[model samples]
Target: MLRIPAVIAVLGLSALTLAACASSPSSAASTSCERTDSDASVLDFAQASGDFGKPAVTLKAPVYVDSTTYTDTEVGTGRQITSDAQDVVFSIAIANGATGQSLVQAAPPVQPLSSWNSSYQGLVTAMMCATEGTRVVAAIPASELSAAGAQDLGVTDDQSIAVTIDITKVYLAAADGTPQYNDRRGMPSVVLAPGGRPGVIVPDAAAPTELAVEVLKKGDGETIGQGDTARVQYTGVNWSTRKVTDSTWENGASVAVAPGSKLAFAPQLVGATVGSQLLVVVPAGASGAGGDAATVYVVDVLGIDDPAATN
Candidate 1:
């Protein structure tokens, strides 16, 4: 739902192809599970040093490129980026390749590559397959830059830009755990796509009279405690029409929710473990649900994020 240029229009990156993209991305790309290997030599004109998150970049001004390219300078053993919608926490540095001038630097929020891809597809490719603690360098050609963004940055399409990124954390792409048994009668059913995206099928039955929950998948990770922020991918539908009402899949981003969150199922999820898939039923008269209609939610608890640690 969040696009690139739309964000830039807010922050003023007239030419930083991704200036607008920096706003937010509800986005992902191809289905290939293979790692995106790169040729590190392509970025010889640009170099980076100093600490991981705080990087100092030196570039040969007036750089030029005909295409976008990237390479990993350091790799971590943590989980890899499985899909475009996978959440990641990282810091980035942006610079003008042609003038060797630095632009903005930031440690952004817990978002998916899908969000960045919506603005600059090149950025997704640069971070693809990268694991936590991995450091990457990407060279983006002006032609690949957003026309409006580059124009605002005062960078000509013929000029290039340099970027250095440090990925600190990565979240699960889906609920990777053992399947759980379900014996609840008259409950909605959930089906998962190959990438672990879920689809719901609500039975033509009466909506529950109270808050109801069932675990469709169980994980071996830590149990969610009070105040823990659960990052999840979920889809919600109205029981009456069975038409979709809200979905992270459509947005290509996962959200961080608290226990008993009204935005989610409004039920306490204290004991739920990470990597668990929850089937939640919110009755029509439930508190704070606005009583539009009964709603069914299939939520994939991807992971738990420390609200303080995350941006």
Candidate 2:
């Protein structure tokens, strides 16, 4: 598995988050299933422990796959995916259906559902209408694998691809990026569009003279600790101008933050619970940029990046 930074540096904000690959098990035995077709028997499927405490898939060996097929190894009881879902996050194990050799096994990563590419039809089908915690095994004909995908697997156009996907989370596309509710008065308001992008609405009154922090949404996951890497989506606005300085929402990705970054609001993020949203106000001269005007930030803490689990 390869660990890629969840976030990248961008204008106005110090950094942005991106997706990364995680590791998986090498092999496992397949479960008993009645083969519907001769070609289907060529591939055997099993579920096993993956890297970083995540679920992994094991294939016995590859066989000639003449057509695309899928099986629901486990059905989830969490949120049911709707057609309106904008993005899906899941882990996957991909291998050559003909040789049964592992191509790539990745931990959960966010994927857009609207991509209509023919090569991605297998993934799209596996995610559409699926619920959180669902485990799916899909076998795709070699013709269906995209050129890039085939190349990545080091297979020719004649080889089929088998993939197992574990659905972990799904997010509805934000309609206008506006928050549905607000409780903090005398503070700049925040609105979120689809994809968790935030828009700051500064109040007519003068910016607060001291640091102000508010929790827009409280998460129930793990608590963030100092020096721990955090995966988050956020937006920054200049108080006086009410203009967006930087935002991960615009990039359609979340970012991972390391400890001691120059971000003025990073300290406030520590000790915050996962899945919580924070709104912080940095008074003039407090933003560390020595500016005369203040800055407001809207942050959504997605999760704590596990340093040991990522790679």
Candidate 3:
């Protein structure tokens, strides 16, 4: 946890962090984020400057807020976080609004927007419209904090906390692309949930003798390069029993894997664009099942992860 409220009084400022290791998917996002002149003027009370993740701040005066308020100081050119199911890599620096004393500030942690909202409700609206590389400031009134949180931070009922949130990375909530047409004649059919999770329905007919590929949705993003690690959501079902054998959706997180032929469908996915959804059929041994049954996989190419990028 970063020095954010989740552990502020106990662990101190350096303890707040948004580690982007493993996390979950999205909920509907509000596009109606408001930025008022008054709020913007209030946010300006705290001047922040430094490297992106960890900000340096020197408050001009002790500030107070009647309600939650926020505004962006810098707008990033990267992907926008439009859904709660989406997870993000972010950092923070918070201080007691009435005392102008630092309380929390840390960098580089990852979690879903829903999780962040649960920890600091006031930050949610600001985050909804945030993009990778964004820097935003928010003021949370004491009323916004849980009674326990206010007590832990030693803030009076009328006091508040001001924080700077740096959004470094943004992960997609689901596959976003144009629908495709494929001859799924006797192949397993695929269906999608509201959040873009996929379900595979194995046909009651014989599995294909050779490898099979079907394009469920054609993405408009970058083409996945061979040997590149890709972020994805997938489900594997046994054609024989029509039972699911594996799924990333169950774990509530997307995983990054390098594309190659060792797993049968991995290589076939290399040329697929980010955001594309595919259905592939792998027979028994080829699927690494070592059984008589074949496996059908439905995968969503969420995005491509550059290994060199920071967490």
lDDT of 1 by residue, 270-309 (tens): 7888778888888887775544788888888877886654
**TM-score, model 2 to reference:** 0.64
Alpha-carbon TM-score of each model against the true structure: 0.81, 0.64, 0.79
Question: Higher-TM-score candidate among 1 and 3?
Answer: 1
Off by over 4 Å in 3: 1-38, 145-158, 260-265, 287-292, 308-311
Q: Which candidate is the best by TM-score?
A: 1
Model 2, range 87-162, lDDT digits (tens) per residue? 4566767666666666666554343344322334556655556677777677777666566545645668777767
Consecutive 10-residue window with the lowest summed lDDT within model 2: 20-29
> Of the candidates numbered 2 and 3, which has the greater lDDT value?
3
Best by lDDT: 1
What digit string (tens of lDDT, one per residue) describes model 3 on residues 32-143?
4433333687556777767888775557788788887777889888888777767667777778888888877765434456554544566666677678888888788888
What is model 3's C-alpha RMSD? 4.6
Each candidate: RMSD to true structure?
5.0, 9.3, 4.6
- Cα error, residue 172 of model 1, in Å, equals 2.9
lDDT of 1: 0.71
